[model samples]
Target chain A: MSSSSAAPTAKPPMRDALVAAAFRLFLDRGYEQTTVDDIVALAGVGRRSFFRYFPSKEDVVFPDHERCLTDMTAFLAGGEDEEHDPVARVCDAARMVLRMYAENPTFSVQRYRLTRRVPGLRAYELSVVWRYERALAEYLRSRFAGQTDGTLRADVIAAAVVAAHNNALRSWLRSDGEGDAGTLVDHALGHVQRAFGRPADAPVRAVPVRALPDEGDERPEDVVVLVSRRDAPVWRVVQEWEAALGRA
Target chain B: MSSSSAAPTAKPPMRDALVAAAFRLFLDRGYEQTTVDDIVALAGVGRRSFFRYFPSKEDVVFPDHERCLTDMTAFLAGGEDEEHDPVARVCDAARMVLRMYAENPTFSVQRYRLTRRVPGLRAYELSVVWRYERALAEYLRSRFAGQTDGTLRADVIAAAVVAAHNNALRSWLRSDGEGDAGTLVDHALGHVQRAFGRPADAPVRAVPVRALPDEGDERPEDVVVLVSRRDAPVWRVVQEWEAALGRA
Candidate 1:
């Protein structure tokens, strides 16, 4: 490799330089036509440097995914607390993926276009997406372990999160990353959250997700059923609750 | 080249013969070691016959997926009426894939084992799965074209159906294709239906998410009741319960 072109590599990280050079050649020539040797030569780096940054040519086309997937796994694992609604937590995890793309609109849009035309790259991208779905599923499965149809629920919700995020993310990329991706993704993930998230007034709230610190555990007297008269107005019950609690 | 051996090709369909021979060779030898020539020779068929039935060596390992994907697309498209719940329709569409695998349990089990060993085959299987998911998504997009977040909802539900179906299907396959695959897949797909399918008597509510009041979609006597621990701070329960009642 020539030392003349190597000056730029010292400025931008060698990894970024390799990606930049690889994309330049891929766009100029084709993905298949651009060899690793050609990329390293253009980037003024050794073959070892190229391999160090990315395992393969296809990976260069979509860098940062490994890091993003790691971040997503960590984000999902961080939601270990029972109160963090699992479905909503997964939806939020999917949002981190969107942010990865949204953070680099131009590069992501470019990569999206490139990945579409190449069948091998498209398949590779699908595999990467599958890994992300699996991560979310693993997290959800642990959370829903004992529930009826737990594994199915976990897999379905995980796939739903990825699908919703990708649908909106792809739309944004198709438009050249022109719109508000957060709103679009949130709108999409909202469907999954509501469809799978626990009900706000779930009567099985004996161990409510939002239980107060004061309520250590349920006791005999904790079953306070006011059994309001069926005909009683809602406001009257509210008043009785207020009075019974000595808060009136 | 022997006429006596070639006679068998005329007896069995060339496609089935090719698949049977390919798998036998794949197991006896290795997938990479067994080439198209080896399969054709074992099947007592010519290269032309093998190529006519399967597009490539990898295609032989997954002989039924193309036909299954086409059938799935057609099945999804046939659900044209508005009365049909799109989510449930897609779930049924995924069941067609399970039936295809379950129809030939031994072959399905063998293929699943082979696929897990080969990275290329796994990626190919994933691509085939991706096509099935896309078909469902397309049908859903059309069915939910104008509704709020229709595209997002369609995509999410479609992926959920595919994920849930595959989760159960793989579990059955992993068990050496034991037990009833239909029952297992049905249980898994049931999650998708319950999560995303519109209720049979669903009213025209703008948001058809979870109406978690059991059969009572909108009960007039819906009330919130919170029972604090006897020794608990009453103010905490009062405040939190007020917030909960406010939502009700």
Candidate 2:
């Protein structure tokens, strides 16, 4: 506990040492079975050093996510490139997250399995993912500050970005991180960007009604009554309604 | 402890009695301070009856969600209405969940407050919400079984529906459930139905690129060369790309 001398230059830092030792023991013994004392003893460090690196054992399981979130926040804040579309920027930020996991295939896969097996760790992981979603939402909120129900827009787009990224990340992780994580995330984020991207002056051809904000809140409710033959096919009735509504 | 005498007709069932007892004790004595014995004693029930009703203390915090999930499943399975758009059907299902919360505003608000104060309860609530999300995803998956990337579509839409519903639900809850929860959820789910409602033959008007499946996975990456003057604004450059892509 008294040794303050730095380790040799070839050695990993005390933080990485703690994480490595913790995961090693966590994999050997179950997460609940391993203790802080065991991690520090195996890492050849003090309990104080372990506490210095991680707040708790669960923190050790997810060491890189905070740094990734910080990087995403900083990337989203670097808005000097005013030309960048907000949706595109958020998608790029989401890619940075995917890249972080793709960087360490072995560790990422191990952590994924560990998280799935532990209920506490699974809840902790959801909280972390929620923070990432919040970051994306905050950035989008800043960009869409002027729009109606912009908060709602920001929340939906952020959830879509996180959900899509997660969908792809889980797929790649399940495959033991062998395939292109980038491609999966890109495909997923494309859905978000296309759904929320550009519309005002240059609307795309198939979604004229998508860009309108929720102005229906102020309008009185309309109950449409469609009169059709009872034996008419449902699709035919729907077709008639769609034609009447200019949606066919 | 063996009381064969039934309660009067005016009395609630033993299950409701347990929930009321648990919440009363949790709010008065704090969740950590209250025990199963305290709850059973407050409800004038035997220890065995408390265990029979709820498996754990956390289970008492969310008494109705399991039944609600079952009911949602039943409502969804009653889908012989082939005319119903899956997106619309799921949106209706989301409305049922909102109605559940709206029906009992006072108890819902008290529960919301209790959940926010207890970390364990909050995590449990997240798990319950996750189950709801899975149910929506399963229904969407069944409806979209044959389409390409149907699973991806199902997952994204499910998350979006849940997120949007939560957004509006929380807003209403924050107001102490005084306002109309239905309108808020309707406005939110409109975003989902618009982005994904009917695409192939009946695309509305603007969003030509939004409906295509992730077919680009098999195709070589698209590299569009947009030749614009060096001084052109970024929007102008983007415009050229959009023009060439036929998305404008």
Model 1, position B134: C-alpha lDDT score: 88
lDDT of 2 at B46: 98
Query: What DockQ number belongs to candidate 2?
Result: 0.16
Pairs in steric clash, model 2: A204-B206, A204-B207, A205-B205, A206-B206, A206-B207, A207-B205, A207-B206, A207-B207, A208-B206
Which lDDT tens digits does candidate 1 get at residues B224-245?
A: 4445443333334434444554
lDDT of 2 by residue, B1-248 (tens): 11112435322499889999998998999999999999999999999998886789999888777767877887778763667688888888888788778878988999999898998898888888888888888888898899877878888888888888998999988899988999999999987776666533311111112222475555433333323222233333333444445642
Cα lDDT for residue A200, candidate 2? 28
Best by lDDT: 1
lDDT score, candidate 1 = 0.77
Query: Which whole-number lDDT from 0 to 100 does residue A71 have in model 1?
Result: 73
- TM-score against truth, every candidate: 0.77, 0.75
Q: What is the C-alpha lDDT profile of model 2 across A80-179, one tens digit per residue?
A: 2658788788888889888878878999999999999999899899888878888988998888888998878888888888888998999999999988
